[model samples]
Target: MNTPKVAEHIVNWLKEYATNAKVNGFVVGISGGIDSAVTSTLCAKTGLPTLCVELPIHQAKNQVSRANEHIKQLKNRFDNVSEAEVNLTSTFENFKTVVPSFESTAKLDLALANTRARLRMTTLYYFAGLHGLLVAGTGNKVEDFGVGFFTKYGDGGVDLSPIADLVKSEVYELATYLEVPTSIQKAQPTDGLFGDSRTDEDQIGASYDELEWAMQMKDAGKTVEDFSGRDLEVYKIYTRLNRINQHKMVPIPICKIPNNLK
Candidate 1:
């Protein structure tokens, strides 16, 4: 079955990579989201030391609790696992001071969203450097590969992504198999930005259900010859994300080394 095989591959990859890389452990951010929770569990299952960071800005107290619960689960499984919390409220405020126009412009919304994401990545990298650990990414296939729901140079930058090929719904299945807490299992997924003013689904204009269906249809060599108005709209949204976020999904351009052999 896909479940057992995927789990085995994850365990094998993490252990072998850690030993081969000579790294002592891994650092992953736990956003109280399913993707991160799954990644953290997979990394911990490898028996390596793991650090889980709770990086919250405008979320409520329950967000912290949920993140801690995920961390606790990881700690219970891995002996060397620990938790850290970093508040970005002050830093976000400081950055706003530099760009006064950011206060009133739409740019502020995106900038803040990006700032939160990058700050978490920065923290994970810090511990990764100090502890000689790799930074594990928490993005799944639907979000990362299909729609690119991560911010560039932020959550998108990581040493490894254990579940980069799994879709959003598939991730839920894995989490259930791994016995992730019920609270986390049922919690609404969000980026925890702007006091939860929106969610990934809200911004995407389609649920993961529809996204997965579309992906499946495409994968199965099927196409909607006659798309309804709603279907056409979803297609446009998906296509737009693919086009606009291409840069985030690719490596930075580098100088080409040309060889002219006569």
Candidate 2:
């Protein structure tokens, strides 16, 4: 892909969408990952107000630092860029207190992690509403379509997705062209929802590169019978996730009433 052309296209797309929608600009949740860094930069390139919000709920220090670094870089480079930091540790704790507690299980832990993402999503929308900006999504093709590795309405909630069609590798290319902070560009991708340093690969059991390949293979209609060894393993992992997370990839189902019944 022509990285420069892709970047230009996305920037123009964002500008046109915001202009047509009658919104001022965009507000993006900065996770210090390459996806958000690239996304916020694309929004900044539109020459409109771009608010980079930092909502941390017991976040890892490195992740927080990377987010701060990226936001600082964007502010320095773009005149329309601004920043907001909302430490949600106390709010998260309060939320946990009000909700009934269960024994520490993987399911409970996962739910809390998702809660963190939802909190950040809410915070981003709050800023967007206040400023009349659209909530810019940072998900890439692999996560959004291939594996559905995003929270349903948490980080997945957005007014527009600038990079949903680009795969992880393609996003990295854009990150390089956008001059995102090297710290973020090189950092392992994580949702930062769990408050620990676990990488997305750890959660998915496959690297983005592997998933991308599997995604391509699936798009070409190849099945598990066509691979072996590590290839087979990755294929199986990818297909299983794609199958289970189909709900995220598709629109919500609505039961239609029959005309005769009506």
Best of the candidates, TM-score? 2
* Off by more than 4 A, model 2: none
Overall lDDT per candidate, in order of appearance = 0.80, 0.93
* Backbone clash count for every predicted candidate, in the order shown: 0, 0
Q: Which regions of candidate 1 fall more than 4 Å away from where they truly are? A: 219-225, 255-262
Steric clash pairs (candidate 1): none
Which candidate number has the best lDDT? 2
- Per-candidate TM equals 0.91, 0.99
